[model samples]
Target chain A: MQVVALSCGNGGKEAQDFIHKVFMPHLQGFLTAEGEDAGVFEARGALALSTDSFVVDPPIFKGGDIGKLCVCGSANDVAMQGAHPEYLSVGFILEEGLEVALLQEILASMQAQLRLGGLKLLSLDTKVVPKGCVDQIFINTTALGPVLYPHLSAKNLKEGQVIIVSGAIGTHGAVLFSQRAEIQLDTPLVSDCQQLYPLLEPVFQSGCKLHALRDATRGGLASVLHEWAQSSGVGIEVEEDCIPILEGVRGVCEILGLEPFMLANEGVCVLCVEAKDARQVCALLQEGGAKKACVIGEVVAGRGVTLKTPWGSKRPLDILEGELLPRIC
Target chain B: MQVVALSCGNGGKEAQDFIHKVFMPHLQGFLTAEGEDAGVFEARGALALSTDSFVVDPPIFKGGDIGKLCVCGSANDVAMQGAHPEYLSVGFILEEGLEVALLQEILASMQAQLRLGGLKLLSLDTKVVPKGCVDQIFINTTALGPVLYPHLSAKNLKEGQVIIVSGAIGTHGAVLFSQRAEIQLDTPLVSDCQQLYPLLEPVFQSGCKLHALRDATRGGLASVLHEWAQSSGVGIEVEEDCIPILEGVRGVCEILGLEPFMLANEGVCVLCVEAKDARQVCALLQEGGAKKACVIGEVVAGRGVTLKTPWGSKRPLDILEGELLPRIC
Candidate 1:
């Protein structure tokens, strides 16, 4: 039972050994664990910065673990601003007695993800708390990157602009729910936990009029649409049929009596682009590995978000409220 | 007792309302809580970046709360790199049933601390977890700043460099211990929780040859000294009697059989300066409110750290190992 002891994060010798043995090998370019309190880096030009703390239950999940989620979460946030995710600072709050092997596995996953976008891990802090003080582990990540396009903003959205979803929605929320419920099923659901910077890089370089981009995360696609509508002071009508939903996600949502529209996403993003560039942007997204990218709806006068069914019926889509699932990241 | 419900972090209408009523009033200038996935900022030139997650037990202490600790902890790290602490992103993980009033109080403390450095709260993420999952509250902060001096590093230390203690040490650790133990001491000790940027700005601007700077946190002064000596492949000799330790902190350490050198510091920093410029740097620090700043040691040709006692005896000051105190931040 090679587990991390309380002394490792006591800011002492054990912590230094853990960094040398576990973290430093993976964080080659990052100046973390350098005995210095902070990591030094160089950045030039306009930058987008974002921070996220991942407290996902069951540190390890199917297809991905908390480590991948941590990277994707912050990197995606920067990418949503049309920035290339470049550098990140990571802080870990580990529960005492956690297995060393588990921590290593998560770090490997993080390294793999960082390599995808050529992102560098710049700084790290590992704090080990007493048992029962925290769950297994919580990771906080802050990402900084040069802004590729300065014009992208929700406030820039206007009437006639269209919305495009990068991929299938609600897979992350559904997979976590099913895993927690322990409902043994043959479908074998996996979380859609992947980096989106690669997917969006081509679209950003395509010279398309990207108005506003947001990762459909906690509040799902509906939440993002509602926010954009409210911020832009315009109504957004997303067609129910055009929105893509995976069969596994749909099945899990159906059994759990959850609305796929309100489910969280880890890898999907909603793009509000000028109406003329909608088709070209979708094509670029699809070419860049966003297989299901397509125009879902358009902006209109008024406020709030509305969903129209295939039969032409329309109704308001409210924001998801309350704890859908605690520690869902 | 108006406590924050789990719904406050569920990314719903309730979370939105909570942000509008509680966070927005205080978070002026930043476009956070705007429903976007991340906040955008402008930056150029070399940037210093750092992150820390504060999980101090007893979130509120005599001089500051976790919020203030969160901001100072990260800002100090960036400042230690000779950078101007500029933009910060905050993430709060709240336990269900935690009082909203306490949360607000902590945020107020954070706001006050930020005002000291002219730092902006650029982004914020509030996640509410189920009760028993977390202990009240844990805050994670990430800071970014322009590199004011690019040559400052632990590796820059050389022989004949004098080390200066910015102020009295060990008060923070002593205060936390007393409060946790519920001891009725005649002297009421407070945490040295102020930001360090203001104190160091003068020294940096005075054109002193600042070799290396480190805030003596966690494993305290001993840890920092050991790290600097080993990193620079040099030995450091300190006069034990010359180190500034407050009377109250000395009392607490003596009563608890602890070494003041091993106790953590929240606001103090240690500087390694060229021997010729030590006096001028110390004078500037004292003028800038670090009244007790003085030469404690000098870097030498050997390795490790040695403390010379007032009795004309020398002994090794090994790295602080084991659990000094958990959640001391």
Candidate 2:
């Protein structure tokens, strides 16, 4: 049971050995610069850059680990800007005594995710703190890419635009909640932790009039709608039945007394497009592997998000206020 | 005293409030993209990218805090590549109970450092973990800039090249060591934590036939020499009397039984230049504010580093093998 030591992060021989023996083998193909102060790459156009830090407890989860989350999370942010995530810079903060095996597993996961997304690893850094200074591990990633479609912003949402959700929501949050030490439920729920760029690639190529694009991650669909409403100064009305949710996720949400709309989703995204292109965008997303893609709502000439119930009632969907779950990402 | 709460990182209204109230006020002038998923910037040439995570214990230190260190550290890495650092993306992992005022102070420091470097804040992310999951805070910064001088690498060192240190070494390490809880030694030494680009600007403009350039950071002068020796398959020999060391730093090193050369320096840089241009380069550095800049060593046709003593004896200078100090950066 090899464990990480303080010497591994001291920028000495031990650290170099750790990088060559442990990290390089896993990240061999993706890394372009091995021992330089910085990595050099050509960037010849408008670039979209995003940064994220993943501190999720129980770093390794049912569907993915923190390493995979770090890569996919930042990639998704870049993709939401109508860009193909091209390169990444990663930083790791490891707690001393963390199992080397666990770190290897996480690194392998990150490598796989990077390969899937066609992202090059430009630079990397590691820092080890004493035990109890941090959890087992935390990962920070910065994703950069060239923008394909410009001016896709939350403020672009207009009154006649329609909202489309790529897939089912809340599975990631539900899975994380069930995996908590206090509530280790025996369910077959896996997180929807994945990259969304591939699914959005065809849509970007199709020349659809994309008004706004965003992945519903931490505060989920509800938060995205509220933000869109506020940013664009428009009202959002969503059909309760039109929102997609898995049975297992709904069950966990019911058991925990949580709102499915407010739960996190890694793979799901909410997009706003012209009303005429709604069907085409949904079809494209479904063909690109988002089987549950559908139009969930539309924008109106008011403010705030509203949920239209099947029983002929409406309720305002407020932005998440109190803490629902910490380290949900 | 308000403290960061879990909800402050939940990507909800509370998170928005925290960003607007706590972070934005300090970082207002630097941040160009405020509410977008990713920041879009123009990158029209070869770019140097670097990433680093700062977890220095005692977030606030004698010379600088973790916030300022994060900014300067990444910026210096980019600058080492002969790049003028232009943009930065920052990620913060905060403990749930960390004081908001302390975080504000850290952000202010970061803002000041970014201003000093003329670097724009492109993107930012914050993640708050539960109490005890992390120390007070950890910051990750990714810096990017257009490469001005290409092909400056450790592998470029060759025989007949001379090594010039930018300033006195080991002050940063000594300052951090004296501030440790176990060793609260009363010392006036301050961490040499600063951005090196401004000082290097004139040298870059002069174009004095540079071979290799690196900031002696984590593992200090010894580590840099050893790396350059191994990378270029050349031998390096430095005179002990020629190496500049502050009296206070030398005193602390003697008391702690640590090699001054193995101690870290944040603001100092080691440069390999043509032997003929060494004197001019040193003069340029001195004129640019590195008052102690001097030729400390020269490259030879062999391997490893050797230290020449004033008593007419030579000894092998090994790379730092064990942990000298943890979290010195």
Cα lDDT of candidate 1 equals 0.85
Q: Write the per-residue lDDT of candidate 2 for residues A28-118, one digit (tens) a residue.
A: 7999788998999998989999999998868999999898899999999999999989999999999899999999999999999988998
Model 1 Cα interface RMS deviation (Å):
1.3
List clashing residue pairs in candidate 1: B235-B302
- Per-residue lDDT for B73 in model 2? 93
Runs off by more than 4 Å, candidate 2: none
TM-score of candidate 2 relative to the true fold: 0.99
Pairs of residues clashing in candidate 2: A235-A302
In the order shown, the candidates' Cα RMSDs to the true structure are 1.6, 0.9
Candidate that scores best on lDDT: 2
Residue-wise lDDT of candidate 1 within B273-318, one digit each (tens)?
Answer: 9999999999999998899999999998888899999999999997
What does candidate 2's lDDT look like per residue over B67-168, in tens digits?
999999999999999999999999999999999999999999998998899999889999999999999999999999998888899899888899999999
Clash tally, candidates in order: 1, 1
Off by over 4 Å in 1: A29-33, A181-186, B29-33, B181-186
